[model samples]
Target chain A: MLYREAGQFKTTYAADMAVFPIRQDRIALALLVAVAFIAVPFMAEAQVWPFRTDYMVRAILIPFLILSLAAVGVNILIGYCGQISLGSGAFMAIGAYSAYKFATGVHIPLAWLGTAISIPPLPGLISIPLGGLMAALVGILFGIPSLRIKGLYLAVATLAAQFFFDWVFIRVKWFVNYNSSGSVSAPDMYLGPIHINTPVERYLLCLSAVVIFATLAKNLVRGNIGRQWMAIRDMDIAAELMGIRPLYAKLSAFAVSSFIVGVAGALFAFMYLGAWEPLAFDINRSFQLLFMVIIGGLGSILGCFLGAAFILILPIMLDQIPHAVGIPVSVETVSHLVFIVTGGLICYLLIVEPRGFARLWGIAKEKLRLWPFPY
Target chain B: MVEFGQFLEILIGGLLSGVLYSLVALGFVLIFKASGVFNFAQGAMVLLAGLALVRSLDFLVARGIPMPVAILMGLMFAGLVMALTAWLIERFVLGPLVNQDGLTLFMSTIGATFILEGAAQMIFGSDVYPLPLFPTDAWFLFESAFPGGILVNKLDVWGGLIAAILVAGLALFFQRTKTGRALRAVADDHAAAQSVGIPISWIWFVVWLVAGLVALVAATVWGTKLGVQFSITFLALKALPVLIIGGFTSVPGAIVGGLIVGAGEKLAEAYLGPQIGGGIEYWFAYVLALAVLLVRPQGLFGERIIERI
Candidate 1:
């Protein structure tokens, strides 16, 4: 009864068209944001929460945001456009390495720089978008094959892109700046007196970036382009008959998806790892991102975040569970168990709810709305 | 100038290596033909079998058992374990996930891949274990009566011969056996086959078990060549291009595709490595397969499938 929205009514078309049409949902979202912004920092500073480590914040939360963005990007193409991609990691790598190059190769003023940069000028902010644009170009190039193939065949074609990018990254010395270690990294950005090097700072930056991109994505998904994408995803032939250009819609999906993924890649490089090789963006990473999309919810932007959190946070939680229970198991053994359990869970999730965790959340919300009057 | 005999030696060795690649690809084809799922875990299965063989040998030797008895027991144990795995997958994973879309099934397989990899690593330890198939001193020398000589190892020849025999036996089994016919029927159309009285789950289990046995043979050959290592599992990615070039459903296509990829990759490394500052061969096979896919995605022998809108 407390969760019922019986008294709520939308008087305007604008109210109905809003992302969260229900007044309750808008309030809940605001409260969630408030808790994240106000409560989290205070709790973290007070060390009241158990997961207050700097490393966890930087390594886990930052990467979580980045990967969520990438997952959203991939979902647009694979879930909405009906184009299967095995090259999401490649696009991410392109974004990362390109961002690294721009950050290092270009110069930025100290006043505009964040504290992550020791150098006088920092180009990291500019490099993020540049990396995304570069990834988009590559995504479009790889997407050309989609014009001819569909389904599993298209998937294999995308796998070709994964190999091509992996090879290029490994073979070309110029991309990695001829580093003997076969790796490249970006310097931290600085904004005058404030340093973005700390985990808290990086997390904030990633959070803001994710929010911006996710908002833009939400708008985009509701717009004309999203309808065309969904149409193409459901039936390309029908979409073509409806005057939607299949080539344009598919390619644009790839471009936009890659662009977001690229930005995430830049964040991943600049904020996390700090140093990475071609092996870092291997096929395994591609699979991990794909899993994130699959388990989170295909065709839903909110699902990306849910999937990323589930895949990323679960391992850490599992590993720490033994400690919480006072068990003396070694970390290695715990990790192995974590893998098996995670695998089993993934299989379970796929079997039980292939649409992903987001769908479950939707059902829960619906149940909440109709709690008193069971249909 | 180098002698013509030297070129022949490289060619012979490359072709032999190609045969072993075909053995691994064969394991992949069997499951694909029966279940329509691209079993990415095939390489891991091969690795598991190889590790089990080595571990069993260690266990038997520690117990003072005879060498031949140990070998036989190892093969039996490995086969049994794989059969169990097949049963578990069919009953729990595949049965529940049967109605899901293709991508969901694909991701599930990937999850299976990681679980297998992690389990193998944990059980076998992270060290590379060598299983001695034959005496190291065994060699076959082809001496040129003129002056220079070429030497080929007997083990390499054995690898080639064993691969050929296994492939032939598999072909005969599929062509002549009742179970194989059922498998083929299931592959043709799952619903139709089920409606006609074929137990879909049982067929899936049997095919996976067959795949597991094939993996054992592949493991022996590959382990003999490269020694069992974690990197071998990644070599399964090599089969992706092969599956694309050879057609997922064709056994002969897998053999031919494996040969082309194995030989083509080695040839690229040999001829073009120096020109490209080396290592182009590593990914060249996949690139070639991708190019071929652009021309014929149905592959060399795959049947064309048209979907209705």
Candidate 2:
């Protein structure tokens, strides 16, 4: 096959250490990028490409991006660092509502400017990190109990955070500025001259952010921090004996994870829904994100993206298939079928390959590299 | 004295509701003890069973069958389905996932929950059904010599009695029977029980089936109290706090935890609802349970676990 990488050779340490060291992989990556930028916009209409509806693109993808970011954050802690947390959604809600307050209460003219000034951004450029920082603060607080408990008990403690956050967000009117509707929403978003109200623009913004975060995550996992996290995940006492501070490693994982998830929540609210209630960030959302990380791959960044796309796209695709086939099924019927199929698939994937789609991808790559040679 | 009577009224109502909460939690504990898996789908199962009962009654009426016979038939059918569900889970899902970690099992249950919810909605339609319990017009209107008048519904008394009977029956079954002993052994240690010629898979199936039947009884009560609607599943969340309070492993613990949560929420609603713009009671039970979990992770009555690693 054209995927063979027989003659590729790394001449330098830089070349050897590159993200895509294989020549064929680099070519594939280039092709993927080219297709995404050039072909996708031309081939599919805006609606069909990202589900074609403005609300669908904005609402689903935006929240999905935020969730994916949060998943990455949780993945670092639970998957990489080996500290399980069921409260990632709580940190996300904190990030989202806090950002909403900042965006609205600051009283700036432009939406992006308002968003920027609300957080740590200077002058005009929006500071995404501020959202992460707020989430991180909450993450650390909830994560403090991890110092005492391990495994399932730790997960339950984090679950307490989830319930507490859910209760606080719904009960406290001040958080949503006493919005009588019991929901909070953000106005339109912008990045300087670029308007993010449109789906394509919003998708681009989210995609770019996902890429940046994913790259940072990938590198972090490959470096010393990743090893520390892996060490902690594999065995805490052994990791401690090996000189890794379990507390620092675990807390840092939670902080970093919460920060990513928090920013995602901001994006989810601002870019996607434009309106949401406390119910929007319920236990279901937490479960969905958790499913993404688990079914994607426990410790791989690429698995996060694959998992997100798989979970998000499958349901939408299933909902559309009934319509596409002229079955005339109601949306609810299709949704039900989607749940059945998705559930069955999850069961299948868990049984077949618990490592998730990422491991499968790795195996395929290995097979391609060794093509035509049995050994 | 009037305030004191009002408190008693609320306390009685809460205790009654707590019985139902404990029943639901008991369902969770049954499966959890027999198999190490936490059946998150317990709430959905409750809703499904309730809906099934309603649908069967409607079907029987449409077919001109007698109401009493129809109701009995429906109960029998529900028990059969629950047994089938147990078999399916043990043979296909849980069997393969036996050695998987807790998180994987958790996700699987969540997936199963979604499937069950969707299936129930598809089959039952999204309409609320009326549930009728025995002696609908009974009430105990006692003009007490106390300062405030406290009135008790006869249905509440019946509900409490029935709940107690069911709990006792379950306890007896778990304590006296050979199957119960086998289940308890599996609950204590799956490998050791299996080593002694106990069929772990069969026990798992039997326990799940028993839990399902319990769900039917709980569903009947819950449906009568709350009406059978999709939102009925939300009541299942009430059981989570119960599990936390009772400890996942204890039946009596579930009962006590349920009573506490039930009473706690009622008292919160009665006393604190007005202060917080009315409805801290909605999440009040969970808050109380969470506090308990924070203080005692193994629950009030759960045995202390000694982790090797």
lDDT of 2 by residue, B241-267 (tens): 788888888888988998898888888
lDDT computed for candidate 1: 0.80
Off by over 4 Å in 1: A41-53, A106-122, A191-195, A372-375, B1-7, B99-101, B134-153, B307-309
Which lDDT values do the candidates have, in the order given?
A: 0.80, 0.77
What would the per-residue lDDT of candidate 1 be over residues A275-373, giving only the tens digit for each residue? 888887888788888888888988899999998999898778877887899887777776777667767767877888877899999999888877867
Candidate 2 docking band:
acceptable
DockQ of predicted model 2: 0.42
What C-alpha lDDT, on a 0 to 100 scale, does residue A42 get in candidate 1? 65
DockQ (Cα-based) for each candidate: 0.49, 0.42
> Considering just chain B, what TM-score does every model have?
0.92, 0.93
True contacts kept of each: 0.44, 0.33
Residue A92, candidate 1: how far off, in angstroms?
A: 1.2
